[model samples]
Target: MNLFADIRLAVIAALDALVAEGGLPAGLDYANVAVEPPRDALHGDMATNAAMVLAKPAGAKPRDIAEALAAKLGADARIMAAEVAGPGFLNLRLAPGVWADVVRAALKAGAGYGRSSLGKGVKVNVEYVSANPTGPMHVGHTRGAVFGDALASLLDFAGYEVTREYYINDGGAQVNVLARSAYERYREANGLEPEIREGLYPGDYLIPVGEALKAKYGESLLGQPEEVWLADLREFATEAMMGMIREDLALLNVKMDVYSSEKALYGTGKIEAALKRLEDLGLIYEGVLEPPKGKLPEDWEEREQTLFRSSQFGDDVDRPVKKSDGSWTYFAPDIAYHFDKVERGFDQLIDVFGADHGGYVKRMKAAVAALSENRVPLDIKLIQLVKLFKNGEPFKMSKRAGTFVTLRDVVEQAGADVTRFHMLTRKNDAPLDFDFDKVLEQSKDNPVFYVQYAHARVASVLRKAAEAGVDVSDAALGAADLSLNTHPAELELARKIAEWPRHVEIAARANEPHRIAFFLYEIASDLHALWNRGNEEPALRFVQDDAAITSAKIAQARACAVVISAGLGILGVTPAEEMR
Candidate 1:
């Protein structure tokens, strides 16, 4: 129900009354007026700058405006007090019934309690996990995958039509490396000692790809030269690697809506079409770029190359699309791919890149700006590194991914739900530490367990109530006389439940999914605190001696569980029904 928005609307209506009664100017701009939580909750539930923002424009003192505004707002049924504080801030405290209504609203709305219409169904494309199809996904790519998937879900919850996409980097030297790597596996399948060359992939994961090639070809590609079997084996090996990647994502419950291959764009005139559109707009030209700031490449030479006028769109300098040798640089297909996305009529595009790709953000944004004619906006989120630990020691590397820890290794150790939730516990641009020991710990220090433990605790209460012959269905709980829950601890939880819808909008507007994680943690903390409180005072417990009073209080606690479950659902984490 967005209680904050409801209160803000009431405040605005009172201000409108002030203008109508001739106490204020005729058409004062109220856009700057805001109703939000007080800096210190000790002040009140919400505070607004209605007085100060209007004081300068109205040629009146802030106290005069605040005093006049307070009298009008004091009459609203929901507002218990509208006291003017420091300068012109209007601090408000809503009645206990207001918080009580929030609990009822949560039970009625269920998991869809915080779903918003902020995006209004705008089309958005999210590109993530664009790793080369050379091997299994590693820890770095895992963060990107989890971040992007959670972002897409968050946007969808905020009423955006989100499309999860993956760009396959098969149109480069990496795929050729995959081909050569598979060629050795092919020989290995032929009962010969395969040479694990210095540059070739040395992972044992390709052993199965070797075995699969033998079954498919059956001596057809035996003893073949590089040119003879390169193309066939490259396609096969790439598919096998992608299959493994899909399985890895499936473990974390991440599913992509689309998978775009860079190789599919080559030789199809798509690159020419996209670049020609830019050229016609005077964005593409043949030029020589100044050498990068400090150390230059050993073979750095000034040569004319095809370039994009990225500087016009806010990049540091014009970027090269084609190298001096007339071959397409790595950015050529990227431009075409983004252009394709722009042509698909998406209102916005978002790219989740690793922190190492920070340098490419500006140029990529510039390309989208030029290609979309400044109509579409692009947001590139750079996910910082993840450091893994076990019992406070660094986790060892995986032999499958050949170097770093693979996503499968982490999932195998911590399980998919723990891995996903722990990965998202930090901001996308901040470093995250995934400690196997800490995550699996069943204490309040572990957020994943704490949140799940809250849900499971609620389940235990419901089961106990059912065994005692009490009807604990959501309909019954929502319909219970929750006015009996007048304890301060119970009221505080109800107030927190009221903040969910507003928090959803704030989190969606900032594009920060971590805020959702933080909110869920706070909700769990409040619930757990109340649970602990009951241990001291038996009267505050869920199952009281009186069945009717028990239903009233248990309903309030169950409502809190409903909101937590919904929030965790948006984050793609499974709420524990019972802690093991």
Candidate 2:
């Protein structure tokens, strides 16, 4: 039901016929040949580069090949006209029946209309929102959470077996700091003055964790030394923090399929095994790294360490796996985690990180490459910062988080659906300004509202049609004589509907879920434009005098709504049945 893909295939078939007839040279690669919408819709419904792409390879002139291809394509019933423009591009005008069929296909497919099998069910692990088990997720993690969740849904729509994962940073020194901070809170629960140290987590969110520890250990851990209580408190506080993080993610409708712990890889021989694999490949060595190019750290010195030859796999330099102090560097556990993923037999891996982690990208990818022996591909997406504003002014920080706005604050203000949709209005690497005033505004300026309003409008039409005794069920609409939808405005909206399948494939292939939001906005614009046009031309209205005509028009509107709902689903936003 993908009109564009079908037309591209037809173009390819025509080229193969040319080769068979000896009109073009044999064995010309047609991979680059494409059929897409013409730049100017006035020119035609579709355009193809079959002639231009094959001209040099076929040892023929562009115009000569285009003329022949045009003649061949014009004979097809679906293509009403095939005119060569700009030397070799063939612009095609499809018959009205073709556009009608697009509407029918959409109604029959419903929300499944745009689903694609591009990934062929390949297992893909999408690790995102891997915030440390220290506190509730903040605004930065919210952006990554929404982006990664939407991407997983997008990949699922495109037929990838997606596993949403969260890599907990519990194995690091940060968790120990969290433990010490919680111990202070525990002392506070026991009527002691808690020392809020400068380097410790200062968020009041841990106050509850202290109460819980007191409930479990009574007064036993209150006066214990660091060595005696540190490990137990770290484990207890890490669990509490994760519970809070899970609650925060639930507020934003984010759920992870896997929660991997960095600490689990310790003493399990996993890190040693991952490094051993690299060592067997001659990628691991004991070496000294040159001092960083720019201003060096005050403690910087050339020291021998266990390093991975990351530069061999396109990193800036070799990366250390172990420090001079005989402890595992931060990168080592990450490598082991990825190695575990590779052993789990995923076909692809994607990591959504904060923009500040950009420097870690190349080295991480290099580690995966060396560990997987280039058998697997890893993609890391860096999500930029989100600037929150309220009433056109900068929003204040959350007192609970102490330093930043928590995810719950954004969700509570805007609601989950609005926040998710607006978060995806910009590319992951582009800064987004979330203005509470602007996003809730019921105007075209608000993409979320505009798109939802389009869906609600179609729902209203369907309800009115049903009340008017017009059979508007999907089966009836799909079988309606949609040739009645021949008006230019109606056909234009149908053309946009036909682009849905192709758009889904493109967005999924690019791993850019933002494109889905953009597509939804474009199609919503088209729906709104056509709806407005009906005001002046009563015949363009969905509820026409004739039942058949009304059914056909309603069918088209329903089709557009179907695609909108599907796209919204991919974005992790629920389509509005009616906007309140």
Candidate 3:
């Protein structure tokens, strides 16, 4: 259960009682009131701004209202003390039994301990890693994949119906380049000297595709001109590249619910329909854009074209849907793709894009806004680059991925779990340095290792309890006399455990799964601190001389393990059961 929310409700009930007893005003808006961890632990467990937030509206002095509210809250059995601090802020110290109850609740719930219903099961579509179907996924798309996958899992844990999607960039000029590149390999496979010209993909990964083409068409396509084989090779090579991409994503344990093709939207009338809808709403127009504020771009032109009134919806400027040559601009197909999502009736949409695509964010949001009529909100998260290092030196490039490091290369070097957790060590928009040596180091500085060690230590405790002939089953652990776990160090850990549900809702509401990682690190730190103290104090050890005391102590450790497992699940990492 959410102890913070329960406490908040208790505070609300106390305020209601104050109003009823004529101790406060008859009507006061309590929506802005908040109960959160105090800024400093020296004050109390939780601090509420009820008096500070209501003093002006209720036409009463802040200290007077805080003193009155303190009396009402002090009567709660769960709150040991409610003291008015500062001008009006009320700090609360929960009863020792409350922390004990949190530990029991955690053991009872296991992996479901921190799950939240904040999303209310709303339908959400998360589209990510929409890289061009040209080559294997590189480190850039790797960050996007991990961030998006973790975010989708977080939303699912928060009770959202999340659909992971990938929009293939196959309808662009990049696919044609991939086709021509494979053709050179095809010639080489047919025992002819291939022309690996400029602007063609030179990666050796396409050698198999070339050999496959030779197997299928043999000499039939050998003598064909550009017109005859370009279309076929484009389709074939794009398919092969997508297959390779799927394997790359699998290396990181990522699976998309849907893989939409940009080519499919070309002739299906979807583009026309999306634009027609915009046109009917008077958002489509013919206009010439002003030159960029700085120096004009090399390809700048003032030709009039069909544009979407994107500026009306907060875009920097109006965006064009059709080029001057009557061909669909890249924005046209993208608009149609988002319209397709809007028509699917998702309550919300989230797009995970690389930091290089920052320029497209405002316009894309404007398109979704105009298409969904502002009914569906869209959030675009831009993931920054991940720089790889090995022992203070820059990591070498991937031999398989040509210029950039491949996702599979990173996963093969560092296992999937290490890669996922290290990638999220920083926020999505912050630059992360993935040091091969540092990440695998068995030190507390390494957050992944530290957190995993905490979980593994719990496992060790469980094994010891079992060897001691104590019942360590979930039922027994949950039914243990948790009141025995009242040590300050032990209660601090339980208090951290009590904050797990609060963290889940906060992370879900912010749409930032990285927060889960940070919370895991904090809770794991608490667990580790308690573990360290147990080394010096025999009473603090998880395994004791008596079965009842041992059970209570092990229960506390197990509760920490349960929450760590749940957090790691959101991060798509398997919790470490045993340390190497």
List candidate 2 stretches off by more than 4 Å: none
Question: Model 1: residues >4 Å from true position, as ranges?
Answer: 26-29
C-alpha lDDT of all candidate models, in order: 0.91, 0.93, 0.92
**Candidate 1 similarity to native, TM-score:** 0.97
How do the residues 1-580 of candidate 1 rate in per-residue lDDT, one tens digit apiece? 8888888888789888988998898889988888888889889888999999999989999999999999998899889999999888899988888877888888888888888889998999999999889999999999999888888889999999999999999999989989888878878998878888989999989999999998888777777778999988889999999999999899889999999999999999999999999999999998898998899889888999999999999999999999988899999999999999999999999999999999999999999999999999999999999999987799999977677799999999999889889888999999999999999999999999999999999999999999999999988888888888889888888888888888888888777888889998998999999999999999889999998889988888888888888788778888888999
Using Cα atoms with residue i matched to residue i, what is each candidate's TM-score against the true structure?
A: 0.97, 0.98, 0.98
List pairs with backbone clashes in candidate 1.
Answer: none
Clashes of each: 0, 0, 0
Q: Taking the tens digit of each residue's C-alpha lDDT, what string does model 3 give over 32-151?
A: 898999999889899999999999988899999999999988888999999999899999999999988898888888888888888898999999999899999988888899999999
* Superior candidate under TM-score, 1 versus 2: 2
- Tens digits of per-residue lDDT for model 2, 1-580: 8899999988888988888999998888988988888889999999998888888878899999999999999779999999999888999999999998899888888878978888998999999999999998999999999999999999999999999999999999999999999999998898899999899998899999999988998889866789999999999999999999999999888889999999999999999999999999999889999999999899987889998999999999999999989999999999999999999999999999999999999999999988888989999999999999997789999999988999999999999999999999999999999999999999999999999999999999999888988888999999999988888889999999999999989888889999999999999999999899889889888888898888889999999999999999888899998988
Question: Which lDDT value does model 2 have at 252?
Answer: 82
Distance from true position, residue 275, model 3, in Å?
0.9
Candidate 3 segments exceeding 4 Å error:
none
